[model samples]
Target: MSIKVIVADDQEIARTGLRMILDAQEGIEVIGEAGDGGRAVELAQRLRPDVCLFDIRMPRVDGIQATRSLAGPGVADPIAVVVITTFDLDEYVYAALQAGARGFLLKDAGPALLSQAVRAAAGGDALIAPSITARLLSAFAGAGRSAPPAQPVEALTGREEQILAAVARGRTNSEIAEEFHISLSTVKSHIASLMTKLGVRNRVEIAMWAYETNRVRT
Candidate 1:
């Protein structure tokens, strides 16, 4: 099935460009477009697209607020959102993530990454731009804050720790399997164990915990 997407940007040109790029991809479809955040939120709530591509700055409401409305921590049924911004500053990025945005992409990140991010978000995965991830993670780490430590680490065997570490480094499951000379199923098993122990919902949260707890540094 094609991944349904809502494009929300104040700029007509940007919406057009994104639509063109995404429409060319194999399994992505642009379902709707909104010129402002209020409309975006309304359309998103009504359309229930698989993923929402939102611009940070918009009139009436802003992308951040729209994101929170659709995907915030308290929302019972959160839709996946990918925030697009012209800047990669710590505040904006952090706010978007806290608003439950599944991905953050610079406005100039190009079509390839934009498509990948949308698909990843649709798949219930998260993808931060590589150029932004390290910097953002470092900043979050250096702030001396940590996610609540998980008791599950004690249950993780050494091999599980190794797998988790690779995941923390942003390695995909296939890549982790290759690195450890294990089968893909083994990688999945390790991930499942880690998730069960740590109470994380997805790989991105796992990676976030690794950084927050000082277990991994970029």
Candidate 2:
């Protein structure tokens, strides 16, 4: 099935561009477009698309609030949201992730990453632009980069530790599997286990936990 998506941006040009890109992809479709965050939320709640693409700055509600309404921590029926913006600021990235965005991508990240982010979110996986991932975490990792991990390090098995370290470093599942000479399924299994143990909804949270607890060096 095609991954149904709602593209939300204040700029008509940007929305059109995203729709063009996603429509061209094999299994993705831009089902609706909203010019502001309020409409974005309304369309999302009504249409129930598989994924939502939001720009941080928007008239009326704004992307962060819109995301929070749809997928925030306390939301019982969260929809997957992928934030795409040109800002690239630390604050925006931090707020979007905290508001329960499933993925974050820069506006110029190109068609390939855009489509990949949509697919990943639709499949209940998370993807953040690698460029932002390291810098975003490292900026806050300094005060106590070596502090004790948020979760007991000993709680994880040896193999789980290895996988957690790789995840903290922003390695994709396929890359982790190739690096460790293991099957992709095994990598996913380890990640699932890590998420359960850490009580995070996605890899981004796992990465954050790893950094907060000093599981991986910045």
Number of the top lDDT candidate: 2
lDDT of each: 0.81, 0.84
Tens-digit per-residue lDDT, 10-104, candidate 2: 99999999999999999998999999999999999999999999999999989999999999888988999999878666466666776788878
For model 1, how big is the CA root-mean-square deviation? 2.9
Estimate the TM-score of every prediction. 0.82, 0.88
lDDT per residue, candidate 1, 1-218, as tens digits?
A: 99999999999999999999999999999999999989999999999999999998999999989999998877999999999988777466666666678778898999888998888788766667777776675566424335455567457789988987777665666568789999988888888888888886566656666777777776
Runs of candidate 2 with Cα error greater than 4 angstroms are 140-149
Question: Clashing residue pairs, candidate 1?
Answer: none
lDDT of predicted model 2: 0.84
How many times do residue backbones clash in model 2?
Answer: 2
